[model samples]
Target: MSEKFKITITTTLTLVEQFQSTLSSSQTNAGQRPNPSTNEQNKDLDPLALLSASATALKSHVTKLSLLTLTSPFTASAVATTLSTLNASVLPSLVTAALLVTPDSHTAAFQSEIRVLTNTALKELFFLVREIQAVAEAKASKKSLDQSEKDTVTLAAGRVWDACDVVIDVATKGVVGFVVRRAEEYRDLVRDAVEEIEEWDPDEDGDEFFDELLDDDNEDRPTSGDSDDDDEDSEEAAAALRARKKDTLRVLKPIAQIYPAIITNRLKLVPVPLVPSDVKVLESLMRNLQQIPEHIDEVAGALYEEDLQKYTSQVGKTKDCASRAINLVVLPWAAKQSSGDQETVGDKFTTWSKTWIKVMGEVSKSIDKT
Candidate 1:
């Protein structure tokens, strides 16, 4: 285990060094750009984007390494060492990337995106750390090997649940921030449109018909503020505009929720069972996952009604947790592996582990999107 850990660390450090080299090159390239304000700066390859990419590469490598051990029979110490290595060697780059992206202005959406990405990455890091810490505490008291292993696996699973909870919390808050900012932008956009329409002067543009109509109206109309029919027409136009605004809000609200909806649904893919303990952990995750859409609605209700309640109810299914897990993934996988009911447990376990890695890939992609 120690030899393997050393090899893994060496390989990871090599990757980190490569990343550092690339980042240095990118910074130099970015500095050479003549214009910093326009899309040309993007052509120069932004350092923050390169940093984000490097963080992603590092995350992928770590996840792959972790999953390799997690799928197999791994000791608590092994997982701990792996996580600690990641925390020490890889996280600095990720933190640097996040800090570099931190802005004095144009920050809300970008900041939320960075926060969710980094927070998601940290969730996995701290989760393994917690499990390792628990295991160490248990071992210091000299617990039985079997008991300690079981406790470690259980604690690890619980830590995964905690990580999922963190993802949910961060995602919910990110979505809320996104929604609030978008709502403000939409409000301002609508206000500006209305103001522009109201401020239009008939004589500003060469509109012959409008100018002729204005001249005729000015000559024929009475000086009394507005006639009863004109007042009624104006009221109807105002009512129509108000109705359109309400309709626009209704449409925009649901549209705004689509990103969060995709994110929440993608989170369902995160907790795949590595061990039996993980099955329970995933079940716990499902219960909370069931509430995510409702939570989103509750938070965004002030902005506009999005009617995500139905979607919330439809998460996974109304069936029992074990049944759902079995039905959705385990059974299907088992049947696929079966050759006249002679399936190897090892192969089935590997398949299950791979499923977890695949889910983590999905979560990683979602994080990138955020």
Candidate 2:
């Protein structure tokens, strides 16, 4: 709960006579104001009057925002700026806003996004809502947010989470462009494929539908708009497949990069505190990675005939990363408990070299079959 907007008339009206103005608070932004020095005070108005009158108006606006959320559309287009400014250290109450049943594509994408939200970011979001409610209530009550207000603050936490859910749903359909740009800038190394697909176009006919699927600099090279009418259907299908294949890969690649780190806990894979959904998301990423073999074969075949060396080298790198991940995971114990001279970096590398050769035999087979 927050304070009510109340003013004590300690000074006589004669001193600030014009200050007894009407109070009409609404959710609208407090737009630009006339300068205090230049805006002529009404000659009859007391100087003390301006301060209390403005406080009352500010209260009304706060109340309107809370009451009107579900009914009145937020006509204030830029409230997003306010939401964006919310500080990040407050821990949110973990009450479910709604039990939503969504598509897996959306589910998986949202889960990944949620999984990556740093603990600091999550806490900040929850706290930011509380801060807003506190400020709004303070303006209204002339007192601080109280106990029942504290419980009511739970409502705000729920709303904040609902907003996050919306962001996730929008992103799963490849809505990452708008979502990422607005919310936060992700780490550069993590956005490799996404950066590429944002520049790609998927229609052979040069339709804007494929042209603008992502936000990035467009390549102007011509596509096959000249394909015959008889072959158009097949061409369109192939184009659609190409578009989907690339975008999905872009969506999934960063997820793949973090897997080795999290699973092996190489960077100390600690459990995320939010919910059990974190585990489910990781499981799905693994399930997707298992399917990467399917794509690699087709893609490798496409590349192998043209450049066997390139295909051979890619398979080698994939195998190497997997082997290192497994070896490091099993050997962190050595680093954790480095007994005397046995704990040197050179010794650890030597152990991993042997360990990988012994464990990743299937990796070679997969590359061979390719």
Candidate 2 lDDT by residue in tens digits, 19-73: 1111011101122232455334332332112222322232333334344322223
TM-score of candidate 2 against the unseen true structure:
0.27
TM-score of each: 0.29, 0.27
> 1-370, model 1: which lDDT tens digit per residue?
3555445444544544544454444444442433345434444434354444545455454454445343434454455465555556556656555444322221334344555555554555454444444444455466433555655555555544454444334434432343344434443443443344344332233578986888787866654556777768766755644443343333323323322332333223333212333334333433433433333333233222223343223222221221332233342333443554424433443355355445434433421232
Evaluate all candidate structures by whole-model CA lDDT and list the values in order: 0.42, 0.36
Off by over 4 Å in 2: 1-159, 163-306, 333-337, 340-356, 359-370
- Model 1 alpha-carbon drift over 4 Å, by segment: 1-84, 104-107, 139-370
Tell me how far the alpha carbon of residue 367 in candidate 2 is from the true structure, in angstroms, after superposition. 5.5
